[model samples]
Target: MTISLPVTVSPRLSKKASRHLKERFIEFLLFGAAAISVFTTVAIVYVLVKESWNFFQHVPLSDFLFDTQWTPLFDDAHYGIMVLLSGTLTSSAVALVIAIPLGTIIAIYLSEFASFRVREIAKPFLELLGGVPTIVYGYFALTLLTPVLQILFPDLPGFSLLSAGLVMGIMIIPYVSSLSEDAMRAVPMSLREGSYAMGATRFQTAVKVVMPAATSGIASAYILGISRAVGETMILAVAAGMQPNLTFNPTEPGATITSYIVQVALGDLPHGSIGYQTIFAAGLTLMLMTLVFNLIGAWLRKKYREVY
Candidate 1:
């Protein structure tokens, strides 16, 4: 009796089978990556809430929110976050005031007015400013800009919110300009042609047509710049001072939430201690502020996105 051997087919022997398997494998990898990112964000939120809860249990929420002082390291420790919040807002406001107009002007020039040669030359230099180290910017604020400001205003402190904010503004300029320019450039050339045909000059077309078309993207860029200014650490720590001042004076030394976190991190505080927990609580607040900015940015992009 003859016995027939069973036949086995290799997947590679069939091109369609191999292609199907490869597609499924690639799909799995993409899904895994997306899931990891989602879970990572969830994990971060969970950790922040858990640690912040522990902190609030020890310190009353009212005191943390409303107290005018933030001397958490002192014997008569106060948990007031407003002092830090004031400094954060003050510096951020200054940064926005400086960055918004300058950045928008730069974007407009690059997108509308600059010749191809000029734009190519200018954009790289603008982006180069962003590549400079934050630590260097901090030092520049501390040594160069602060002295110059002191010359202008004799009463300004060596480390003031004004100097820090100015330097931070300089740092954020590229981010705003680059994003806004890209948005403005993305506006269809047809819009410009239409405007030109209807008795519009280059300036008029850019201001009336392109600006409105790219408003959402420009707004998102500003929001991201604000987020950057808020979350910045080294520059604020180096030039904005570590003193928690409740006043909104730019010339005064003040601590931001970011500065406070840096201060705590540099110390040798024991794990799970009140001091350690303080940083976590402050971190959660910072996280929430950034989250709000990001949410607003996403909403603006969705609401105002131009199909063209």
Candidate 2:
């Protein structure tokens, strides 16, 4: 008889249900926001594949990959991506060589040795380097670093990979140092104390215990630095000549894939034309190169990340 009556929910229960529904709604919105990134990545890959498929129809894959020259504007256009690939790798290699040691040293100094005041002063200024405009870096490379290199290696060209790479290295120093320093700082103070208890000097503790523990993050920083160098456009475009040369010499002029894309975009090529579409192909190649670097970095991080 008591159950026969129609039951109405209590006001408190209704309010609780409403609040639960609101929480779920907010969660869905957050999930949707995260999903946007995946969608964006998928969109990029789709566009690249679609246009690149059309491009490959006209140009053979072998010539694109293996040919030693990239003359997409020539009467007999060659789609040799190797020329650009070499230049890109050369500058990136140079950037890594300069950035890795210097950035690591800076990170160690900041994390282990620097006074609080020095860390406060230097960290902000170092981060400021990353905020500077790429055009300024380009100009610095063209006018400043190139001149310095010209003094050292008098035979260096006006626009050479060396100058561009050096400036690019300077540009990425903040990325490497900031990340590596943060990783080193994340090491438990107890670990340093333990090292000291074992009769280890500050340098030995930092090099042996902290560095090994922070290897994953340091490796990530290095990979990201290389990625930044490879993807750089303005510095290379302005300082490194637009000529795509397949040489290992760092003092020579060269064009990276990004530079080539920038050069092509500056012109008034019709949409859907071969010249226009070639940029997409180059972009795809650059994307793949960066992807490989990221994959390698990810693998290293996974393999080396410490439980602590």
Candidate 3:
């Protein structure tokens, strides 16, 4: 065979090669960014499960689940999750009741009816409301809302689920309204025009065509609102009294799972003690609850997802 000479790369080919290498490098960077979230999630699950497993080994799953009280810090040491769950559910329910309808109405107004000037003015204020510190909301709940509620209902306590939940609802309103408005606004203009062509009013078009087209996004907003309500800590801790009461009545003072965790985490409970381990167990439970809600959200998104 004849001697083979090394092929010389043209300037164009060299540039192309450099560009391809850069593209690969960029792809690797993007993948690393994506993987970071996955890694963090996995690590969190591992730690929670490992610590919670230790907790379960010490405390029977039956008592953890079925006991009526949650006095893990006391000498009696009851570990019923239901008490915390009840408070969480009650507060979340109250928050949802206030948030969903009002958020939806606001979203519809902003997306479909509000003038551009009004929308521009309102959105920044909504964002600012969301940007306010949760601790501030907690104090506001404690100092302001409770007294107002007490005025309305003489029996309402200074630290009540109703006050905490109401404030939480207000706090999460921007989350729901902002996301839902974006989803609604994303609907194609052609759909609105077609509805008008069909003699449908603006309200009708917004309600029927645009809403259906944006169901996936609106559902996502609702899901985010639910997660925010469920996971709220400071507001409940400062205002809901952290009593671990197993009552669904929002008028009563109670502790949510999150508030209890915060209490134990800040307390002088010794490491490896059962009382301390309770936080890990509670953390695991919260993660699972959030996971279930996420799965539900995924299902809703899939079920109502529009091609457009």
Candidate 4:
């Protein structure tokens, strides 16, 4: 006999359905937050590129590219890109030097060597370093770091690339350590166990087996960290003076592309002037630099990504 079932839901059942709807709403909001990031990137790129194209139209490409001088306010000048490029490369290279080894080793130590209790305590503290403001690092570089550097190298200038680069390096160490640690930790415990079972010591197993396996992840972290170092502005502004000289002397004062724009933007350069356009051009250059690093990081992740 077929019996008709009554359409009924208890209060508890209805409440559960409401809860599921609320949960879905929250999940959707979180995904929307991620979507906004892509929008932000696009907006910034549009502004930079649009204004930069306007700049290139007015300023001759040859003078901006081949000229070895940059005097936007002077009677005659050459706004060559090499000077700012030098500053970016200098700071980034110095940071890479300090970050790669320190970050990689710390990552290894934290993931493989530190006790469980130690790791629990260490990770948050290490990540905290990365969260510190870049401006604070800049201040520390100018006031604290500069004085110490002067004592160490008497001939060095007060505000120079050395001070900025070193500060930037210290600032980025946390990023490298934290990200690389995650990569190293992703390796299966079984891999380490197998290496150990083959009579390898902990360090040997880490270097010979685990590290090699996690190479792609580490490389990706390194590239991303490099990108951070390159794009950093505050430290360069405070410690590295705004003098865009075509020299690689770390002891000499020099300006990064960012510092130059900041200097110009601070009412010194009026809107719609050729000088104003210079900033946009500089922004485009910086954008391209960042894009290059991002591509490199992506390539590394794809090429060396480990499943296990």
Candidate 5:
């Protein structure tokens, strides 16, 4: 009788239950985190789109999109975003010109050629640039950087896009260099050895073999760096001035979208006014542009990860 009753339950079934419970818990945790991030992102986009729609309801979409003059403070309104877009792109492009080559070169030296001691010293110094408060960079760009650039281009405007862009570039160098170095370091030692065995010089191996391997990662970092440059506000606000000039003159004062938002917020612009709503629309535009950059970066990283 005892033997007959014993077969109904087994130790295997108990262990299986425990493992199933643990796996479910882990799955729920992962799903919860992803859900939270997705929900937050959607919520933000929803708010921006909703508010921006309200803006467009009163101010025609065509005028907002096409008007050259960005005078949002008129009975006959022209909510042209081109001026703000111009400012954002100008600052980002200028920062890119300064950041890309320098950061990439430094990353190469650190990952491929620098002695251990030099890397130890330089890594901390570079990371320190990122930690410095953006507001401080703003102050420096306004007071010190503007003066220095003015001395070089004395005929140019003091608080110009060039000055803000340069400071923004310095701030972003840590981002690009650190990420690019990681990408470079990920190349297999065997590959480098293989190239060396082929009688290639160190420089040739680094330039051809290592760089090709790491190109995707480097491109991702570069795109993210540009996103940072585009989103920057304080340095542009303080050093680039609040003039939203839709021209490519780097030597002239120009305002970015963030700077324009700051200018609008600081003034006592009434709620529900075109001025108040314009910032939200501009913000939505900025968010969309940065989102595009992030998407491109992610794609590049996924593509180039194994090509080396």
Candidate 6:
């Protein structure tokens, strides 16, 4: 004989509850997405470190560091990392020399000088250039660029770092120019107007006022270009002959750490073998090199960051 009454939530309160639940759901989704990337990066680093540790166990750290020859596959294996390091450095140097100056100039032109019509038309072309496969560029370097280089200097080998580096620079030009131009264009128009009021020429405004204001973003672009140059694989693999030599000569054919890894990866080396383990060690080295460059870039950005 109990009298029971049901209690119901008000419409407003129910609606608010629903909204709160939806917001939490969206936030959780975003958090999950971010966590995926972090987890993947951590997993990659763990694998590389684990395998590299296994490699170091078999090869002494001193010999790996101090050796001048890299013949890990040969019967008398010598693990001088410098042989690959030299090639990597030389090729990267050549690429940077071409990319930095050219990309900066292109960015300045597009950002400051190009009309709206020209900008619209040119941007797509630049993006298209970036989208082309790296393998096509590799073959172009081998078949076309190498022949052209031979005409200029007959002593230039068919498969040399110069050919590979030059092509790689061209391939990455869009990456540098596009990012740099975007950074430059992001500079406030008021800054340019102020420079003009101060009797600065268009070139002066672009070079001095705008460029300094956009330093952080431009530094980021340069860093991306450096990373691209350092990590380029097929162009160096197919164009630069896969020969391990400890020399900083771009005109000569040599093997980079990347090319060596590719060679070993495509070969039938058994898993867990010493030769197979070298790829992980080389990968760790490459990752360290990229990390150093990124740190330098970060420092540059911090040192030159502009609030306005």
Alpha-carbon TM-score of each model against the true structure: 0.91, 0.93, 0.91, 0.88, 0.89, 0.92
Per-residue lDDT over 84-197 for candidate 1, one digit per residue giving the tens place of the 0 to 100 score:
989999999988888988999999999999999999999999989999999999999999999999999999988999999999999999999999999999999999999999
After superposition, which runs of candidate 3 have C-alpha atoms over 4 Å from their true positions? 1-34
Which scores greater on lDDT, model 4 or model 6? 6
Ranking by lDDT: 3, 6, 2, 1, 5, 4
TM-score: which candidate is best?
2
How many backbone clashes does every candidate have? 0, 0, 0, 1, 1, 1
lDDT of 4 by residue, 1-308 (tens): 99999989886667677788999999999999999999998999898888878888877888777778787767775678777888888877777888888988899999889999999998889889889999999999999989998998999888899889988998898888888888888999999999999999989998999899998889888987888988899899899998887777788888888888888877666677778888889988988988888898888889988785
Identify the superior model by TM-score, candidate 2 or candidate 5.
Answer: 2
Q: For candidate 5, which ten residues in a row score worst on lDDT?
A: 1-10
The whole-model lDDT of each prediction reads 0.93, 0.93, 0.94, 0.86, 0.88, 0.93
Which sections of candidate 2 miss by over 4 Å?
1-9, 12-30
Colliding residue pairs in candidate 3: none
C-alpha lDDT of residue 26 in model 5: 100
List, residue by residue over 1-308, the lDDT tens digit for candidate 3. 89999999887656677788999999999999999999998999999998899999989999999999999988898999999999999999999999999999999999999999999999999999999999999999999999988999999988999999999999999999999999999999999999999999989999999999999999999999999999999999999998899999999999999999988887788888888789989988988999899999999999998876
User: For model 6, how does the per-residue alpha-carbon lDDT over 163-258 read when each residue is reduced to its tens digit?
Assistant: 999999998889899999989989999999999999999999999999999999999999999999989999999999999989898999999999
Candidate 6: segments with Cα more than 4 A from true spot: 1-30
RMSD of each: 4.5, 2.8, 3.4, 3.8, 3.4, 4.1
Model 3, residue 111: distance off in Å is 0.6
Name the lDDT of candidate 6.
0.93
Comparing 3 and 6 by TM-score, which wins? 6
Residue 193, candidate 1: Cα error in Å is 0.8
